[model samples]
Target: MSNHARELAGIIMNRFDAFYRRFLDITLGAKVRFESKDWLGVQLAGRQRIRLYDHHVNETLQAVRDHMGGAPLGQEGLKALKQAFNDRLTEHANPEIAESFYNSVYRRSLRHHNIRAENLYVHGFIRRATDPDLTPYCWQYRTNTGALGDCLRQVLERLQLAVPFSDLTRDLGYVDRYLQDHGPAELRGGEIGLTFVNTLFYRNKGAYLIGRLEQGGLQWPFILPILHDDQGGLNLDTLILSKDDASILFGFARAYFMVWCPVPALLVHFLRSLLPNKADYELYTAIGCQKHGKTEFHRDFLNHLHQSRDQFELAPGIKGMVMSVFTLPSFDVVFKVIKDRFTPPKEVNHETVKAKYRLVKQHDRVGRMADTLEFTNFELPLHRISPMLLAELQQVAPSLLSIKGDTLVIRHLYSERRMTPLNIYLEHATDEAVQDAIDEYANAIKQLAAANIFPGDMLFKNFGVTRHGRVIFYDYDEIAYMTECHFRDIPKARYPEDELSAEPWYSVGPSDIFPEEFATFLLSSPRIREAFKQQHNDLFTAGYWRQLQQNIEAGCFVDVFPYRRRQRFRFLYQQGNDKPGDGASPP
Candidate 1:
């Protein structure tokens, strides 16, 4: 035999000896004797010695080969077969003591392989070969003869071949070639097994010194001694800790169990890494009513917030209150641990606290007030402009912000201060400025309409301006379909005729609505209106609105007024002023 084959044979022999000894101990309640010449001999305490014949070793090897799909035995396969042989020997010698051993192996193997309950192929084979349905005797056989038999049968079936010594050798050769070509380099090392912890830290982390330990790589500093011995073999659980304390004593347990451990330790570690010795943000709480649900909805929302606390940097606060409906008695609110800190406005005094916004009880008996609080600043013309304005416009500069469900999260901006659309004209003295602003705003509404988004509470107070002067829509409750929108030629009186009421609210189709009047409602100022008509007269014409209405109804979903769609102009205006090139600036 070649050196590798000799090594393999030695490993097989050592495994057999261990199995034989363990079997003797369990069955006969005595240790087995071994001859140096590959001979296995067993003895009962009060009985004559029983010399193990070659048939026993031959049969076990055959069974193991059969179990491994007739493939050559890898280190893991060899270890398992050795364990099975020991179990079987114990069972045959003393069936009474064999039950526990058998059960332990059976349960472990079943769990390790994730064998489903519906896998009747193996179960059926065992049932046909044994009595009492193989269920009661499953444990005893599993430890000893049964595990080997099952493995052999499974391997043979997997290979779709007859069970024989010759076929087993042939299959092993095939498996050897397959592994030689395709197996990972690390796995090619003799008698070594791959594990995530070892590979992750050693190979990927470039920690070559630690890699030499192989399986010991997973034995972290605190967990090594309990797992290994002076001879370097693993020490079983019984020798390490008592059954009750075994779970508590282990430092690095299974991956799933490690995940289940409390997150506070990791959280602290992360915080320490980011801002060592510095104080962290305090938690804050906000309360509001569900648009169309009960307290359960509110509870679920709180749970979601708690689970994503790390993402939000939220700290803990009070329980607040639970409400059946949005009312004064049932409403509750809590403050976050962190203080609301923002840069003070340039005009504000350093020592004075500016009351920029207010947080109030959701159910306070304010007139026409909903449970939600309005976040605003008086310096910005938010109330006079649009309620659903962009975040950038509300501040001093432009910013990109998005709404996560009900909460607005600003991002990709240096500061929260946004520039309003009105501010765009305040600094410049362009003649067609007001007309340009109206056109931009009109185009924004048209885009929203084309997307089937009907702003139910479409009012100036609801919109905001970004630093870039682009309008942004934020409110979700009143967001609906353009198809559900209705427009009147003139403002409707408080007491309108019943003929104006559209019935079967859900039956409204996209084709039934007209959105051209949106420009009139949106640009209500007379000065701005006159400017829009003068500069863009076609904007107010019926043909323009009609064509827009047709495009929206057709559901093209394209932007009606994209920034790139603006008409190119050579000069600001033709006011016969001797300004260089007659108002035409050089490109």
Candidate 2:
């Protein structure tokens, strides 16, 4: 490879490497140790790694499916799996779909062989093909017969041409040679586990990021923290798999591609122009300021608002999580800055950033989120911020945002509502307050779900009571749509091993959601819990979620009125015909 190519390759690799550690921490609950470039140590201390028999890719698939409680190619599972794949294909073709696709792929690979779908696999042959003779070697994994090759054919049918098994094999050999001379074998303690591959030839389509974690199975089942991006801001939008049934394959096919291809030729001209000037920051600017091409009036107002609030001070909100609310002495609009780093980037947690943006943008439409100012960054030079406000923010939301060096900047969310957190109000309870709280909470949940949104964490702190006494969800980090979540009944642990194990016996897919836990999680005290049970106990069952999901899927809109049931018109809501209560109230 030429010097230009090598440099471009390094730049490409660096972009992917940025999120590698964070991905491991969030997805696999593991850590990474960079011993050297070649040998990376993925510490598996904080996770569950089950062992598998040698060369049992199919069995591992069954085990993984069982762990996630997914039926193995059962009618429903097959439908869901196919939908998942087709979802990606559609997203690639067009971006108008409302449902944000998070493609998470898992690989249960073998030697030179790579398996993508249950029936889709990739294989490599050692000898290069010339002219028209692209025959596979006998050593090739199950070629021209059975499920493996048939699977590869399925994938090949989708691509332009069948990639020769030898092209990959020849390039992989180049990587091995490079590593033999300049490798981290010694520093890795020969423990990076590269001695054998189930297959010798495996190639993957789509973008490759770094290995995020190490799940220590008897043998590795794909690489943990393996992230795939199919053009969604380099987010972990898709999970790609490389499964093979072969032996003596090295660490990664991507590594070899980088070593051999180097510049990729095409990107060099583009990358070179940026080299003379520090154009990388232009890319960083693109990421950080994605919502704005250049600063508009409103955006500039938000990005530079701190400068104007000189003598006027604001007090931080008390007793809450997920947001740092500051009270304006003017006492109207409170500043709600998403404490910097309050949520992981979408690359790790799929739609967190998108969810937040949705909540703010749709606040009025959903009749929820306190009318918000544009989501922007708060920039307060270290010298400008008041000591009292800083100390208060630190006390209430220590992790909300932070000050680095001489500057403090964080994602800001300014809202016009001067509402108290419902949890705080509940601390000094009243019958009226309790009734309103219960009614508003239920109303918000139903309305949001009706709008296809689910606040994944339904904690009291996440909800607020507007001065007019309506409860609305303010926190959006864990928010997701009702359609995306797969509500399920918890699977009972059958085996003693499963019961005793800390990790779940059943498989936990990324979208698997258990509505059964909501009752205990949302309703706090016994009184509040019983109150919720009296009104909305159905929330604790899978049936309710399933029906609601079905209803939404069937093009039904279940509108939830914002007013309390007690306050509704007598005709709109009556408690067992008990004189239907008060005034000309309407829901």
Go through the candidates in order and give the C-alpha RMSD of each one to the true structure: 31.6, 26.7
Model 1: per-residue Cα lDDT over 37-145, one tens digit each: 1111211211121123122344445543454456554445434543444444333432211222222233233432332222211111111112222221111111122
**CA displacement after TM-score superposition, residue 83 of candidate 1 (Å):** 34
Compared with the true structure, the alpha-carbon lDDT of candidate 1 equals 0.28
Candidate 1 differs from the real structure by a C-alpha RMSD in angstroms, to one decimal, of: 31.6
TM-score of each: 0.23, 0.40
Best by TM-score: 2
lDDT of 2 by residue, 395-506 (tens): 6556435576886655445544456677777778786668667766776777677657777778777677754566767666677778899989989879878868877778
Off by over 4 Å in 1: 1-432, 475-477, 487-524, 534-555, 559-563, 566-587
The candidate 1 region of ten consecutive residues with least summed lDDT is 202-211
| lDDT measured at residue 420 in model 1 versus the true structure, 0 to 100 | 36
- Per-candidate Cα lDDT values, in order, are 0.28, 0.39
